[model samples]
Target: MKPCPVLSIALALALGLPVPARAQSAPGQGGPTVIRARDDALYRELGGQEAIRRFTDDFYDRMLKDARIAHFFDGINAAYLKGALADYFCVSAGGPCDYDGVSMHNAHAGLGITKGDFDALVEDLQQAMDAAGLPFATQNRLLARLAFHHRDIVTR
Candidate 1:
């Protein structure tokens, strides 16, 4: 389904807000060009902060109920996890949310999180995004941002 017109406009504004000069990109030859901060287009496309919060909430709810990944959440504070995820997504999507959670490395350190578990988490997140009816581009954008943290979160 097409996004609502109002959301489309908010996305544009959220992404088009002037970024700092240091965050600007220099012209480069072919291949992917990197922007210092989060991509505004992707952020706007994701429907901004409220959408992110909804996505995170739904994602965690699914994770908690899924037998495949529920074990990983054992002993973890569900509320705290949800709050941290909200903050993380907020920052990751170029919103104004502040993430005060421990660095990914430190947070997952000694948790014995294997690559398989990490992949499962990604799959579940994808499922959650799809269930939320987000566009594919927005899903990919969020996934790409989260993928960078795998190195720090996965011990194996």
Candidate 2:
């Protein structure tokens, strides 16, 4: 059976090493081409479902304490928000999970999010990761992926 991508990544990240890669040689080529075997390293590095859950919890906790972004979540359902965020991060990090949430634009629509708000959210996430003991490189990698959605998420 093919190994789960997360399993492979889990080993590498847990060992304090970079995610494993592979090299392929062309039939007539003298050199091998290096390539990443899986794009799900971020998901695995985040420690799968359990770790993601913890991270999400920490993120919300941090966000709630941050005056800049806390008001945006007023009266919101925390459980639902965390679940959706986990699913979104799972898919964004190439994990083997499905995200059924609305598109970034649709989700933030009518919320009047601004660039400052977006930056605050990112900061909150970083703090959450730090609290969760995620490696700085790992945190950066995950944030980079999430940053791609900022353009769609911030419309104010």
lDDT string for model 1 (1-156, tens) is 633333433343454433322222223322112222444665677777788788888889888887877888988888899888877766666665566566676678788888667766766676777888887667655666666555677797
Worst 10 residues of 1 by lDDT: 26-35
Model 1 stretches with alpha carbons more than 4 Å out: 1-39
- Per-residue lDDT for 47-109 in model 2, tens only? 997789888888988999999989999999999999988877776666776665566666787
After aligning candidate 2 to the native by TM-score, how far in Å is the CA of 23 from where it should be? 27
Q: Indicate the TM-score of model 1.
A: 0.73
lDDT of prediction 2: 0.68
TM-score against native, each model: 0.73, 0.74
